[model samples]
Target: MKRFTCQSCGQLLHFEDARCDQCKAPLGYMPEHAILSALAPQGGGLWRPVRGCGNTALRTFCSNHAYDVCNWLVPPTEEHSDFCFACQFNRVIPNLNIPGNMERWRKLEIAKHRLFYTILRLKLPIKNRRQDPQEGLVFDFLDDSPDGAAPIMTGHSNGVITIATKEADDAYRERMRVEMGEYYRTLLGHFRHEIGHYYWNVLIRDGGRLEKFRAIFGDDRMDYQAALQRHYARLPQNNWREYYVSLYAMSHPWEDFAETWAHYFHIVSTLETALSYDMTIGPIVDGQATLTHKSDPYLLMPFDDIIAAWLPLTYAVNSLNRSMGLADFYPFVITDGVRTKLRFIHDTVREVQQAAS
Candidate 1:
């Protein structure tokens, strides 16, 4: 995610900030311009960007803002719609009247909004069910059955991504992480991984890249159910690290793609944050090389350049985490095989971006 600042007072801002601490100015994120702008009230719930903040036209907060779950702006052009570009994708939200569901929904929104940030930043194609009824991306945040029936499983089907609301609880998520033996897991990671499935349908299956995809990620046509059953039934290969980004990625070709795709997002987004902060890693030894953020990872950096910057950054941050008595900031390794899959995803994203331009 790119760093943001309050345009009115120049106070450093986070992507989710609703107000500027220095100037006490109300803030709203303008997704079209990808800026979090300080706002000036214009009566009747409308607001305009403070002078010199950008877009002079009046705007209003998304309907979800009423729930304090979204901080995105709704432009006059989209006044007919009640939700922002990101919120419009919601097919079902959690039951707010139920105790604790409100907080869980808020956490879900934060992660979902961040997911949309990367999606928009990369200029990926996305639509709501209204635009493409057959396969438009949508979300369903659901609760497990209260009567002791089967639990909700978070996954994607066609264009819908369902997230088990319980995952929003940190304790629950952490427990599951231990039981599943995952190196890393979070709500944002879940969004990134599942959206990969949605994009596979759009950018690979429909975009005519299946042949190339198969050669790199293997044949996705294999029996997915059987592959998953086998994966759970047997022990992971001792050498799985050589070929997969995570143990779960060894389950199926589709999973490998999704896992790698999620890691690709992790790499580029974190690199962009480092670049925004002008972060650099100087050589510890006299003649060793230095790492600097020289290019925009989302727009200009090649796959090789991204990997070069990411590996060193990971090393630096992971060490910082260890020094502070925390787990590695990035727990997975990027092997040559994993890099090949990541490169495929990077190239495919660039292709879609160029075509759109």
Candidate 2:
């Protein structure tokens, strides 16, 4: 979400831009540093990267050059690799040889990169299966076979994430949203929410925070299959709003954690954006705002401080959203009971950071 510049012409560039209109420079993303750099064309359509990146020594091409779905640079060091960091996470992408699959894959990567940007910004640990097969993350970008050979699924388990290829299609996603009765659905939201599932394995189960986590999210040891089946079997009761963020959270303790984890990123990222703009008035300077640097996350702003700020901030945002024609930016209100659950999530994150340190 930070602004990018074209190294070739020094013109401001968009993250999604394949070519800079001002200088006609080819652009590529430096995935390691989350940068978008522009390139000057050499003869024979070989674009020379003008950015002072280590990857340049490796001589790489952006995914845009291949499928137009990737903006991330693939270093020559990874010459044999077919995907960038965002695309690399995918285990079963649609058939790229298909006319539309490349475009579909492209959309999914954009959202995946956005998800990664937040994870990186927060200084969260990320290791893919290719890097660490034992516990590293992976993804499956699949679909109900075009030939009707198999059904597709999108969910997270253990350390892997799966996304249906149809989720990449705007029309298909909208149809699913209506059919599933969801108020909001986006590729970004799915990545964010599913990664929330991954982080539970990464952060909570390993951090010895399970007891406290169980106290709030219910017991995560419960059977996931039965819980999920029961949830879909009956409509989630709306009256339980005071206890959970979304109806899906009512499905199981693991779900509640995942939903809350996603919300934590939502709150932290937006607050940092607001702070970057210096958009606050009458600064009651929360201590976390002081410690959690806008550019570098040293530590999560104190868990208590964030909740205190959120209580009022979400209220103001909801009211403002109503004043405008749009629906509420944050549809779910965290009640007092839910606040206790969120506190556990916040504390567990700190524990993870401490353990990593």
**TM-scores for all predictions:** 0.97, 0.79
The prediction achieving the highest TM-score against the true structure is: 1
RMSD of 2: 4.5
Measured with C-alpha atoms, the lDDT of residue 53 in candidate 2 is 42
Cα error, candidate 1, residue 46 (Å): 0.6
What is the per-residue lDDT of model 2 for residues 61-149, given as tens digits with 9 covering 90 to 100? 64445766766767656766756656677666777777778778888887887787777666678888867897789878876866787
The Cα error of candidate 1 at residue 329, in Å, is 0.5
- All models: lDDT? 0.91, 0.73
lDDT of 2 at 228: 91
Off by over 4 Å in 2: 7-12, 40-59, 62-65, 74-83, 97-99, 147-150, 235-238, 277-300, 304-324, 354-357
Number of clashing pairs, model 2? 1
How does residue 138 of candidate 2 score in lDDT?
Answer: 89
Write down the lDDT that model 2 would get: 0.73
After TM-score superposition, what is the CA distance of residue 108 in candidate 1 from its true location, in Å? 0.4
